[model samples]
Structure formats: structure tokens, C-alpha cells
Target chain A: EPEVTQTPSHQVTQMGQEVILRCVPISNHLYFYWYRQILGQKVEFLVSFYNNEISEKSEIFDDQFSVERPDGSNFTLKIRSTKLEDSAMYFCASSEEGLGNQPQHFGDGTRLSIL
Target chain B: AQTVTQSQPEMSVQEAETVTLSCTYDTSESDYYLFWYKQPPSRQMILVIRQEAYKQQNATENRFSVNFQKAAKSFSLKISDSQLGDAAMYFCAYSPNSGNTPLVFGKGTRLSVIA
Candidate 1:
């Protein structure tokens, strides 16, 4: 089975530094998403991308966060300025398009640890 | 807003036994999809099972099955013949029936299978 792939499985950065997480979604998938989970907390949606544009985003997806589909298969999330609270597991997911309702296949996730 | 809830924080079952994990969601939309994802110690999010809200017939895959109740907005996972390999953090997720939306996940239940 084809799986989403994320680079830099684990990353440690300073609180004020910038970080970028990358993902390569399944080749035929049309929708991409980013979500984060703080330790022992729920996984929260950050943003959704389709047609090379952001379709929707949650409140947690503030100014510092951005997503891009720079190429056909590569989707990426960039944090302009990281905070200590930003430490969490960041997951990238993809699904074949129609609405936002299809089953999404997820990546292994990048453990972002901010010091 | 839609929200997914998994009331059980932790559960344990002896090897070769059976276990059930409960999940509920609040959504006004009738068409959507529900899923159970497993996060192993390696923190890789793996898709275990999925159910369509409009399908009365539940979904089953190998030892994994789902009891999906559309009226009650409840979707529960049943794992029979559980093994130590089943130990993981299980998250119940809700997604819209359309194509571009992101998945909403519960806080997750940690399942431990004892030998």
C-alpha cells in the first residue's frame, strides 16, 4: 500500500527559530492536511489544502503557520516563529478529493520539540 | 463545529481476549466518514478501520470491526483476539463526506494488551 512520507522524523529547534516540515502525499491524492497533537491531547486540525490553495484552516492555524504544495506531490508546513508550546507531533495527511469527508491516509508524523 | 470524543483514556486486555473502544461525535451533517487510527510506540499513525456514516452495515477488517450507529452519532471499534501488538494509542476520527476537509480526532484511548 502507498503511504504518505514525511521528512525529518524528529526535529529539535530553539523557541524563536523557524522550522519547516515536509510531506509527500500519495501520488493520486488531491487533498492535503496538517494536524498537530500536543502530548496527551487531542489531534487538532491546522489547515487543509486543495487545488494548490488553502481550502480551510482552524483557529489554531494562526499567522505563524503556513502550508504549501510547491509541487505535484510535495506538501509542506512552515512555522515562521516557533514557540515552546509549539512542541508536538505534526502529522501530514492526504485523501482523494471530492469534499473533505474521505478517509485520509496519514504519515508517521514529525516530532517537533522546541527548547 | 464538529467534535469527536473518546471517553476512555486507557484500557487493557489480556492476550487473545477481546476489547472495545467507544467513540461519539457531534455533527449536524448526515454524510461523513469515521475512522480508527492506531499510533504505536514508534508514533506512526496507522489506519485500522473506517466506516461510512450512510452505511448501515458496519465495517470489518480481519480482527478489527466497527459498530457504527448513525442515529446516535456513535462509532465504536471492536478488536477481537487482541495481541500484544495491538498495544497503542487509538484515535477515533470524524471527517465530512465531501473531499477537501480535514479529519477531527478524539483525544485517543491508550490500549495495552497484556501477555
Candidate 2:
């Protein structure tokens, strides 16, 4: 089965710095997403991308968080001016058609550590 | 706003036995999807099973099955013949039926399969 691949399994950054996490979604998938899970916390939705644009985002996806499908294969999440609380495991997921029954496949996740 | 809840933080089952993990969600949307995902030690997210809100019959995949109660907004995962490999953190997730939406996940339940 095809799988979503993410780069840099682990990342470390300083407070108020910028970090970009990159992911290559399944080749045929049309919808992509970025989610984060704080240690010992629930996985929270950050943003969803379709047609090279953001379709929906949660409150946690504020000005600091941005997602871009810069190319057909690469989906990236940029966190500008990261804070200590921004440290978490960031997962990238993709769905074939974004239908109800279609399951979203996820990558191993990029663990971001902000000091 | 939609919220996915996993009441049990941890559960254990003897090898070859059965185990059930509970999940509940609050969503006003009539059309949506629910899923159970397993995150193993490698931190790779794997889709265990999924259920559509419109389907009255629960979905079963191999030894994994779901008990979906649409009226009560409840969805539970039952793993039959649990094995040592079944030990992982299970997350219940929800997403909209249509459009490009990201999944909202519950605080995971950790399952330990004892030998």
C-alpha cells in the first residue's frame, strides 16, 4: 500500500524561531491535513488543504500556523515564531477523495521540540 | 464544534483474549465518519477500522470490529483474539462526510496485550 512520507523524523528549534515540516502525501490523494499532538494529549486538527488552498482550520491553527501545497507532491506546514508550547508530534495525513468512508492515512509524524 | 472522547485511559487483555475500547463523540452533523487508529511503538498511525454514520450495521475488519450507536453518539472498538502485537495507543477520530476536512481525534486509550 502507498504511504505518506514525511521528512526529518525529529526536529529541534529555539523559541521564537521558525520551522517547516514537509510531507509527501500519497500520489493520488487530493486532500491533505496537518495535525499535532502534545505529549500525553489528544491529537488536534490544525489545517486541511485542497486544491492548493486551505479548506478548513481550527482555532489552534492561528496566524502562527500555515500550510502550503507548494507542489503536486509536497505538502508543508510552517510554524512561524514558535513558542515552547508549540513542541509536539506533527502528523501529516491524506485522503483519496475526502469522502465519508475513505480513511485518512498518516505518516510516522515529525516530533518538534521547541526550547 | 465536534469532540471525540475516549473514556478509558488504559486497558489490558491477556493474549488470545478479547478487549473492547470505548469512544464517544459529540457532533450535530448527520453525515460523518468515525474511525479507530492504532499507533504502535514506532509511532506510525495505522487504520484499524472505520464506520460511516449512515450505516446501521457495524464494520468489521479481520479481528477488529466496531459497535457504533449513532443515536447515542457512541463508537467502540472490539479486538478479538488479541495478540502481543495489539499493544498500542488507540485513537478514536471523527470527520465530516463531505468536503476536505481534517480529522478530530480523542485522547488515546493505551491497550496492553499481556502474554
Stretches of candidate 1 above 4 Å error? A98-101
Deviation of model 1 at B27, angstroms:
1.2
Candidate 1 displacement at residue B7 in angstroms: 0.8
Instruction: List the DockQ of the predictions in order.
Output: 0.72, 0.82
DockQ of predicted model 1: 0.72
DockQ of model 2 vs. true complex: 0.82
Instruction: State the lDDT of candidate 2 residue by residue for B1-115, as single tens digits.
Output: 8999999999999999999999999999999999999999999899999888999999999999999999999999999999999999999999888777778899999999999
* CAPRI accuracy category, model 2: high
Error of 1 at B19 (Å): 0.5
Candidate 2 regions off by >4 Å? none
For candidate 1, give the lDDT of residue B49.
Answer: 89
Which predicted model would earn the best TM-score?
2
What TM value does model 1 have? 0.95
